[model samples]
Target chain A: MLTIHCPCCGVTAEETEFHAHGEAHLKRFGPGSSEDEFEGYLFMRKNPKGVHFERWRHQYGCGKWFHVARCTMTLEVFGSYSAQTTEPPQEIMDIIHDRRPDTAAGPAR
Target chain B: MSDPVSALKNIFDDTGLVRVSEIGPIGMVTLRGDLSDKVLGKAAVAAGGVNLPEQGQCNTEGSQGIAWMSSDELLIMCPYADVHARLADLQEKLAGSHALAVNVSDARAVFDITGDHLREVIAKLAPVDMHPDQFNGTMFRRTRFAQVPAAFWMPDGRSARIVCFRSVAQYMFDLLKDAAMPGSEVRHYA
Candidate 1:
């Protein structure tokens, strides 16, 4: 029963309305690409054990696509933002710290 | 004869303002791929000039319509008469791409459900919150309607349209009939 924040609707919503798209920030090669290059792009994935950024779709709600940063081990969400935004929302980060006192020591930098 | 399409027609008449029209033989293709990929983007443009709409959104070009069913899936619709040739052209243009275009035209049927209470009727079936403001223009949905797999398109909230597999059309029609008749006893014997 996790409440995920939607950057499009600007509200936390039940997890059922959103779908987790694995690992964000993928790079694509141009046309007439080599076999190894294309294979690497398609088959590679990063299964990080700690804080990671992932894409998610607000499927049943606003239907907008966005990104979320969370700790993979604890499933503690740190922040969420629209795909177009360069930075995550500060308020969301603040709330994350407020709710999880132990993680409030400092930023994940 | 208790046919499903006819049953739908009967319900439409009883509902007063609503009218049901069959958009049969329409060519429907399901496209799946990464939205940000250039190859996928080119394939979408080659299919019809417009990229698939955002999830829950529909893009219409003349008689053709494409709805985004999920982040990586899109439903393509074109008039029955134009399907075969158009699909071939699209397939040729999208060759070698990491996308997959599946022909599902024969597997589905399209129904145009229009009139004032269409939204209310849909609320009785699907789990989506189909409110006027939240799900208006450009909004579409891939959800279950009366326990049938359906993809809905709302040109406007007042007039709702649904496309579903042909096999479940009868089940949906029966659900609509019972819904229209409130407390009436409409039993289905196996």
Candidate 2:
């Protein structure tokens, strides 16, 4: 099982202790946005095989939601950060770039 | 307004390798505030008569027990008789801070299980690593017990104090009994 380090609880718990909730840092397209933009926000998702970002709840650990940067292909977790922020921190972004230089510098649109 | 009743009248009297007992009419509150704020800790101690535990730890001073639920949260448990007064006192102490004190006594069920085979039974139900080397008295874990979410702490080698939402108390109790059967396999520490 995947061992996820829950920053809030300060525990590295097994996958059973967590619940993955899809993409992290999702940009919301609320009222007044174009239909296409709203549709994209609702149904569009990233299925990257390499470095991917995700939102996960440490449901059985801290009961807090957090973000994770991981490689879908190799299961190499880049790192975890708090869910309270709007975007991944610069240090985490730098680590991702250092490990997978091919990834773009900003959030994938 | 009505008098409270115990879910399990005498679970403590059971004879087996394990003994499970309901632990309240106790005061329970979920306390939230910035961990870095000294006033938050001070307020918690003021209400519960004990220092707030650090991450993954639990502390008991007198009838009050504080379990750290996360970096900025803790569960304060004390005698039910003192609940409302303690809540008011805590709110007063934390008036100027970014804090929330929620009374959860009615929403929770607390149970204590003691046995020589405590860890063995728990291994069957949850994915937690309860090897004596990895977990001990100072630690508490929020984890799923079988299919329901629960949290527990081993107060000693032979006992664990477990808490879960009241809705799932019966399910949790039955699951523990089934896992502690005489022929159940004792999980080896990895």
Candidate 3:
């Protein structure tokens, strides 16, 4: 089970208490937007074996949504941060880069 | 108006290893604000008769208590009869501030589970760490009690005060009883 640290409550809890909400940092397109963009926004996801960003809801704890960065291969959590931002915080990115220098800066395919 | 009835009607069970009692209807205020802010802290202390507890902590003086439910939420407990008055007082004190103080006594249920191996009984249910070193007095945990969301704090070494939604009181009561049943002891936290 993934151990998640909720940025809002600062509680490190098991994944059972949290609900995964698919990929994070999603930008929505609507109305006059092209069908491709809308379809990509709804269905396209970065299912990377390496580092990936996802959203999580602390369902049983504080009932707040947050972001989690982790590696799908090793199951190593990069870090968790607030959902109020558009991208992963610099600290988490820096840690990821520092830990895996050979890996690409972001999820690639 | 009509009489106030608790979800479990003060049901007590000692037939099992531990003592499980559906505590009487107690006053609970779901106070939401910036807990770190001095203004909110002062209002909480004033209304709850206790200082604002730290994260994952609860401070209780008899029936009056203030538990840190989250970074922005506090569960202030008072006597059931005094809930409305306390809530109004909290609201008046928090005027002009971004805050929410509402009485949640009727919507919630509380239980007192006491015994020598109470931790073992609770450890079987929640996903929380139930060891004494981690789940000691003053520590507050919001977790799934079997299936529904519930919170619990050790009032003392032998007893815990569990709070959950009133709608799940029956389910919570049964979960606790079954966990604390004779011969069903896991002896992990024992």
Query: Which model scores highest in lDDT?
Result: 3
Per-model TM-score on C-alpha atoms: 0.60, 0.87, 0.93
Model 3 Cα lDDT, one tens digit per residue, B144-165: 9879999999888889999999
Summing lDDT over every window of 10 consecutive residues in candidate 1 chain A, give the lowest-scoring window.
Answer: A100-109
i-RMS of candidate 2: 1.2
lDDT of 2 by residue, A2-106 (tens): 788887787887788899999888899999999999999999988878878899998877888899988889998888999888888888899989998887845
Stretches of candidate 2 off by over 4 Å are A84-106, B10-16, B187-190
Name the lDDT of candidate 2: 0.82
lDDT of 1 at B10: 33
Every candidate's TM-score, chain A alone: 0.73, 0.91, 0.94
lDDT of 1 by residue, A1-109 (tens): 5568776655355576578888766666558999877886788776766556678987654467898878778887877877875445677567656765565432222
What would the per-residue lDDT of candidate 1 be over residues B63-160, giving only the tens digit for each residue? 67787776677777776556667678767766877778878877886677765566666666676666676567887766667556677777755566
Ranking of predictions according to lDDT? 3, 2, 1
